[model samples]
Target chain A: MMTRRIIYLDNAATTFPKPEGVIRAVEECMRYRGGNPGRSSHSVSVAAAQTVYSARAAIASMCGAEPERVAFTLNATYALNLAIKGLVRPYSHVVISNIEHNSVLRPVSSLSSMKTDYSLFDVVGKAQGDTEGVLASLKSALRGNTGAVVVCHRSNTLPVEAPLEAIGELCRKKGLTFIVDASQSFGCVETDIEKCGISALCAPFHKGLYGPQGGGFAAFGKSVSDREIRTIMQGGSGSASSEVSMPGYLPERLEAGTVPTPAIAGALAGAEFVKRQGASRIDRYERELVEYMKKRLSRFDKVKVYFPERSCGGILLFNAEGFSGEELAAALDKRGICVRSGLHCSPLSHRVNNTLSCGAVRASVSAFNSYSDVDAFADSLSAVLSLR
Target chain B: MKKCYVSMSTMTLAQKARNILALNKIKANVVKLTVDQSYGGCSWGVETDCDDQEKIRRILDISDIPGYRFIRGKE
Candidate 1:
């Protein structure tokens, strides 16, 4: 009996069929160590806390962060919100990339409505071989009151990446905080906190780290002062109870309320998986798939691929002539190819790629995806194009 | 400065207490407890010098870590 595997190309949204040992760790945490971390010093509680700490350490080690400074959030959105709202004060100016995801835009927009001013730097220029042009755009966007600069490591709408290290250097020279939304690039790319001058690196454990959903982390660097990065949400931190005010610490300062222990447990195993597999190996495997997918699928006249120059992550953005992104994706779906169509919660990315009218189709692969899976996608795309 | 043990309900809180003490200039080491010292399979605690025990106790009180009772000591 042969059972066919569903060709999932939506790793950008979330990694499906999570890597091995992740499920077992989640189940084990819920069943065996069912105690509240930091609430007390009971054996079960301490054990649970150890598991969470180990996960944090694993994630931080990979991100080039100190374990104690990494704070767990409900998801990357929460982490991003914490970073954005925590940094921007009233009347502060900020700079952001033009092709940011909604996670970055929505929170920054909230600040805009309040009083903070912001300017968007052109990142599409970097993708078009204008590296110095991108740097100039970022420099031009900065103002005297610019307190922070936010950028996405890679665009979700395209396979293109922003000049993060350059932006980090700019932030350092300007003495402004640099925040990176690493949702689409963390596990597949290296984000050294110090080298990149990242004040806070926000990402979900699921997408690239191959961890569970509902778990996100933000690793804060030394650039974020305890006084500057204030708390947005405050409750029982389980660390400092004697004072009415929240405790002034790295993780405990940011984290308040009960954490998602089960998710953290799963993330522990997932981080272990990433560590064992190594980020470079995963990047190499995904790059191979992306290369194969691009070469095989682009020969069709109807297919117009964007960011084909990318050799980093496993993401392909394209449009089929005479067919809308939604329609093309639907046809692919019928062929057991799971892909994301439309804005992908990132309207600005479409605007940057000149896909404002009809959103582009995204087929993002994971390390687990093989060459055969990509071949299936290409074959299905060709068959669908011929039908049209 | 006699070395002693201060056990909390959870390793997370114990580690926190140790960090706080260090920040306040009180010396302490966080370590996994020996099997004989544990009723359960595994246990961890802060090892502080007796000279700083009162200081650590005062700091812990100020921390207000919930349900924080000294599980064991006097080893």
Candidate 2:
């Protein structure tokens, strides 16, 4: 007899079974518009460039920015690197949260040695109690030499939503650059670049955006001037090849070499899908599922759930004693339940929560997850607890 | 206060029952009935009167109590 698969609850890492149109768009790009975007005058090149432009427009609209201000990169990490390295000069100070992913941590760590000073505030403890703690930390950490304030819109582990507007206002008042890492909340939550006062935003096409994993982008808000951000990578921008150096422009200044046309096309389709479904609806659905899972997991005597009050995204962290996170995850995997068990690339967050050694099991949901999926997960967890 | 007693191997389940009681703000003592050697876990029975059964059920609803069942005492 064949047993049906129980459920999938790990969507924060990357969304699976992407929308049909997303796959279709990538296939179409590969088949029809397989040319270097912005590099040629042929019809194929124009078609590829148009596809990329369409994607940029969709992303810009999603974040409330001008389409020209958006530049494609390899992934959110790359976009963040460009923003971090390009915006901060030598002897500049930077502020970041402790709960940030390695994508932000590693780059900042390496850059700090090159005469850039940085301060990391522990936001995990405060995130559980107050959402504004992230912004308050950023404001307090600001110094005269502080050039940028980098933040993750939502912590990948706890699903805590940062106060982007307040942080943006603080950055504006202090004449500092506000760069946001929206890899977790880009498609799940509505982000208005103008309202949040964000000077720049870096996001991946995968994960919440529901696209392939190769494409990412950064959008520069109106508050930031073109001259302030230096271009780190200079190469063929496909337009100003006649010039000896990179053009002094918005996107072309940052974009180097041939872009990932297929991934960008897929991202456009994914963003369109999100637009049609509505970000608010997706946010509400995922939040309800997380709340339901938290409520159900709290019943187990051996299970310890960590759910903050103000979190509305998908991720949930918890642990069961007498069992490591890997052991609990393995038990659930036997029942066809999918979850991630680790520090989730944030060792600082785990240290703050005292889960460094065992690391809590993280079950993140997406809009595609159904209520029945949550119920099945709850049942499987119950079975595992019964064995304890 | 009425006292009920049962035997189980581990105190994890007992602690969970206590948490459920605290969440519901109910006052009662939960005693483990027996420990199953095969699973190395225990079976538990709630010892509240008919008046507190509904509140206990509400607690169970929110607590995610595992292997929960009502067992009426032999009168």
Candidate 3:
């Protein structure tokens, strides 16, 4: 059967229909600048290195971070793994938020085998704008062995954001490292390294940044030292090949094995696009879309809305009364409306929301999405509410 | 364009030197020094127009990358 017009609303998974010039940049890199970056010093390699350098500068300038501090990885999952494993060792303690994505939770959990202990708590206080409550939970969780605090800057399910600066301040007061998982919020939110006091940030260029898949990064703050975090993986870093040990510099230290030149090239374009568009613009646009979708969906009698007080970017979580989350999503899909259903890979968040059994539908937006797209989604939801 | 090669003993120094030049608005090209017949070491060289020779030399000096050398163009 022929599908109706498809309106993509699953940008939180990974942005579709990347912005202008991004595809061209990736194609150019694959065609002409395919040399392995920092691996060789041939003419093509020089050009590739330049492309990588330019991308770093773009991301750093946007994040208010130094270019040398940013290291590209396969995706946010790998980046988060590097940060968590690097910081926590055996007998160390860590504090993670309930709002964390699996990317952060799985890595922290893996450290359990290494004898690392972590406390899992909720971000509702921060989500609801209760600053004191937010601080209190963090304060209570910190102990002598608690070396770090990891949190999701924004909740992907509810699309709600916490005050990163305040969270960072709490971590600072306790002398603990602050790691932010920005997989769902990075380019579309305010995440300046200095302002947020983030010791390390893991984000996907393929998500809010609007690049092709396979591009992710972990950018560290100025005070963070390579000596504090040991390398978890080791491979050819191009530099210091004479030495058997991995190079212990910022980018090269964390970046093990062959760097993906084309992916990095696409990410460079994505970073440039976000830079040009400005964070506030993207944030405002996405905010409007989320608010619009939520308002429209709330009008239906059968629609049961599950949302936070205020969300920073694009997302609306809700479920129709008679329809299971998956059933409603399938009906919408038949009508050419795409969205996410189920626990969204964060069972802790679902349990905290008291919807672990019946997951809510997550409809997220992006810069490419228009209000008309939201209208289409709203209409589709209204039609399919009784179908299941 | 006339060219000169700034050769370093290792890859890191070569990359650092090249980045510095690029940040300063100089169009510097990095080439593997091992490809050269006269150069046998596995290092890198930043190739730039001869007009940038003095500027490149100055920046290389300030960067203080140890054992860095310069190879000028024949023409």
Q: Give the per-residue lDDT of model 3 (tens digit) for A49-86.
A: 87887787778877887676788888988889888888
Model 3 chain A is weakest, by summed lDDT over 10 consecutive residues, at: A239-248
Clashing residue pairs for model 2: A299-B63, A299-B64
User: Each prediction's Cα lDDT score?
Assistant: 0.82, 0.77, 0.80
Score chain B of candidate 3 by TM-score. Answer: 0.80
Instruction: Give me the TM-scores for chain A across all models, comma-separated.
Output: 0.96, 0.94, 0.96
Candidate 1 TM-score, true structure as reference = 0.86
User: TM-score for the second chain in candidate 1?
Assistant: 0.73
* Residue-wise C-alpha lDDT for candidate 2, range A136-191, written one tens digit per residue: 66667778898878889888887666778877888888888888999999997888
Q: Write the residue-wise lDDT of candidate 1 on A1-388 in tens digits.
A: 9766589999999998797699999999999987887666568876788788778778888888867678999999999999999987778988888889989998998997768978898877844556799899988998888988999998777766777788888889889889999999988887899888889999998888888999899999877766568788998776445556666656776778889999999988988888788888898898788899889987998888887776657888899999999999999898899999898998988887789889989998987888899889999999999996
Candidate 2 Cα misplacement greater than 4 A, ranges: A1-6, A122-135, A308-310, B1-75
What DockQ was computed for model 3?
A: 0.23
Which residue segments of model 3 deviate by more than 4 Å? Answer: A1-3, B1-19, B22-75
Judging by DockQ against the true structure, name the best candidate: 3
lDDT of 3 by residue, B1-75 (tens): 887877764344566677889888998766666545223324566778898888888887886555567787756
For every model shown, what is its TM-score relative to the native structure? 0.86, 0.80, 0.89
Instruction: Report per-candidate DockQ.
Output: 0.12, 0.00, 0.23
